[model samples]
Each structure stands twice: as structure tokens, then as C-alpha cells.
Target: DLSINGMWTERLEDSCEKPDEHPTPLTKQQLEQLVRSLILVEQSQELRILAPEIKVLQEDLQLKKANVYRSIPYSRFGSNRDAHCYRKAFPYLLAFKVSCQEWGQVLLRRKEWDAVLEHSLMAWLYTSELPQWDTASHNALREQCYGVLAAHILTALQHCSLEPSRGHELLRRLKMAQLQSQSIVPCIQELQRILGWAQHLDCDL
Candidate 1:
């Protein structure tokens, strides 16, 4: 009788603690509030991660801008030159360089073979603005930057595993532009040499 009573009590407690067959419905306001709270939490988390990235980006941009400004010649252009030519060219040149570097970095990260080819061609377009010499030294810093840009393009082309006809066109334009710069024979020669190497790349795909 004692054992039977214990068994009966256990069964009663089990049934009482069991979940209901039908669940209670949440109110519309309650649902909305829950969603809003979740959104706030998610946004707060994203802000925490993005804030530091944004700060780093701002610092990098300031450094790049300063480098560009330093490269500009403060002396006025020749008597025959337009007074505002340098002023007009300065900002555009800086913007172009920054865009080129950032885009190159993106291509390096993506390793998109075709895009790498496209970037390589785009790089030549910017090369025109890079005079062999500017402000003191061999422009070693600038050249290194361009070299890294070139490497990224090369790596992307290699990893993308595809043909780069579109990239070929960009190189063609660069070659033509370089040819037109006959006064700067060395620039033309250097560009031609680079172009030759770029043209012969065997894409993986």
C-alpha cells in the first residue's frame, strides 16, 4: 500500500508539471517591443566593432592626404603655365591615388582574378600622374606603394583562374599613353616593360 501510494504521487506530480498542449499567444505590442529590443542590442554591438574601424580609417586618410600635399610643388607654374593648374590638379591627384590604393587593397583581399586584371589596367592610368621624381628622394615610398598595388593585381589574376581580356585593354591604353610621352623615353620604356610582363600572365582559369 505504501509503495502504491508513492507511485501514484509521482505520476500526479509528472502530469502537473507537463507543458500545456496549447501555448498562450504573445500580444502584438509585446512582439514589437521584443523586436525593437533585439534590434537595439544588435545595433549597439555593430557600433562597438565599427567605431574602432572608422577611427583607423580616418587616421589613414589623414596620413595619405598629408603625403599628397607634401608631394605638390608650392612654386607657381612656369610663365606660360596656368596659374591654377597645380591647385586644380592637386586634389584630383590625391583622390586618384587614394582610390587606386584602396581599390587595389580590395582586389588583393577578394583575389578576384578578373578584377585584379581590371585593377592592373586602372593602375597604369594613375601612373601617368606619378612623375619619376617628386619631392626629394626616389619617391621610394610611392614606388613601393605602387609595387604592392601591382603585386595585388598580379596575385588576383593568378588566383582568379580566368582569362583577362578586359585587363589587356587597360594595358593597351597605358602603352599608347606612354608612347605619346616621347619626351619621357624612360617612362615609356618602363611602362612597356611592365606591360610586356602583364600581357604574358597565364591566368589559372
Candidate 2:
């Protein structure tokens, strides 16, 4: 029995001493494919988790007729008639704003200039769709949103190679926005200046 045990142990030792085979290193293309697959999987998982929350928020916004760009305080049990129910929508509006900003950052990183421009313009349009509230807080929020959009627009315009027709179209959209004229004016001017420079350089060439 001892001799048999010794023989078994020797066999195990020999097996352990043998060199183990290593996997061949992945090719560059294969590694890239793997990374893309991993990214897709992560994005899908994130979507699944966020979808229900998004639906709930959408329903809440619909029910409240909430303007995601505006915030007003809710009336208390014995509050004056001037107080409104806009506070209920504040959280949802905040979420929407955060989501938009995050998406904008992603687009900026990817250098999708056209999409970035469109995104900022769309967000600015949404703010303008609501009535202007005269309160300081409301004015500040509106200006802040406009400032962000203006920055995004400027960045897009500076980086994107826009054709004459596209530049004219952008100008038309900026004109249509009408709100935050100060912010919008600068963006319009910048776009025109960039286009002018491009044309001048082309003429020189």
C-alpha cells in the first residue's frame, strides 16, 4: 500500500513538473473587438437598469405638465395663491439636465461636433419654450443653462468644418431661439466670424 502511494505521489509530481501551455496572445484586432464587446455589454446593462427609472420620470413629468427648465415652489397647506406646484417637477428637471450634460460631455469627447451643436441648440430651444419667470432664481437658472449651451455651441463651431449652407442654417436656428439674446448673439457672431475666416483663407489659397 505504501509503495502504491509512493508511485501515485511520483506520478502527481511528474505531472506538476510538466510545463503548462499558455494561451497565445490576442492579436490587435481581436483585442479591439473584445474591448468593443465589453463596452456594449456594459452599456446594455446600464440601459436595463436606467430604463425603468427613466420611464417613471417621464410619466411624472407628463402628469405634472412639468417644464424641465423651470422650478417653482409648491404651495403649502395654507400658502398664498401665488405659490405654484412646480417644485414637484424640480427633481425630474434636475435629472434631465444632468443627463443632458453627461451626454454632451460624451459627445464632446467623441468629437461629434454636429451632434454636439444640435444637442446644445435643442436644449436651448427647450428653455425658450417655457414662459420667462421674472424671479432672480429663475433668471439665474435660465442664464446658466444658456451659458452652458453657448459654450457647447462655440466649441462645436470652432472645431467643426461647416459648409456655407450649414453655417446659414445654424444662424437661422440661433435666430429662432430668441431667448438669452446676449448668449445667443455671441454664438452667432462667433459662427459668422469662423465662417468668414474660412472663406478668407480659401480666397488666399
TM-score of each: 0.36, 0.55
lDDT of 1 at 168: 52
The best candidate by TM-score is 2
Residue 201 shift from truth in candidate 1, angstroms: 11
Name the top lDDT candidate.
Answer: 2
Span of 10 residues, lowest total lDDT, candidate 1: 1-10
Regions of candidate 1 where Cα sits further than 4 Å from its true position: 1-74, 77-99, 131-138, 164-205
Give the clashing residue pairs of candidate 1, or none: 161-205, 162-205
> Each model's number of backbone clashes?
2, 0
lDDT of model 1, residue 189: 37
Alpha carbon lDDT at 147, candidate 1 = 58
Kindly provide the TM-score of model 1 when superposed on the true structure, using C-alpha atoms.
0.36
Once fitted onto the true fold, the runs of candidate 2 whose alpha carbons sit more than 4 angstroms away are 1-84, 131-134, 197-205
- Among all windows of 10 consecutive residues in model 2, the one with the lowest summed lDDT is 1-10
For 51-144, candidate 2 gives per-residue lDDT tens digits of 2233332332232224333344544554321214333333333433443455455567778888888777766765554435434464454566
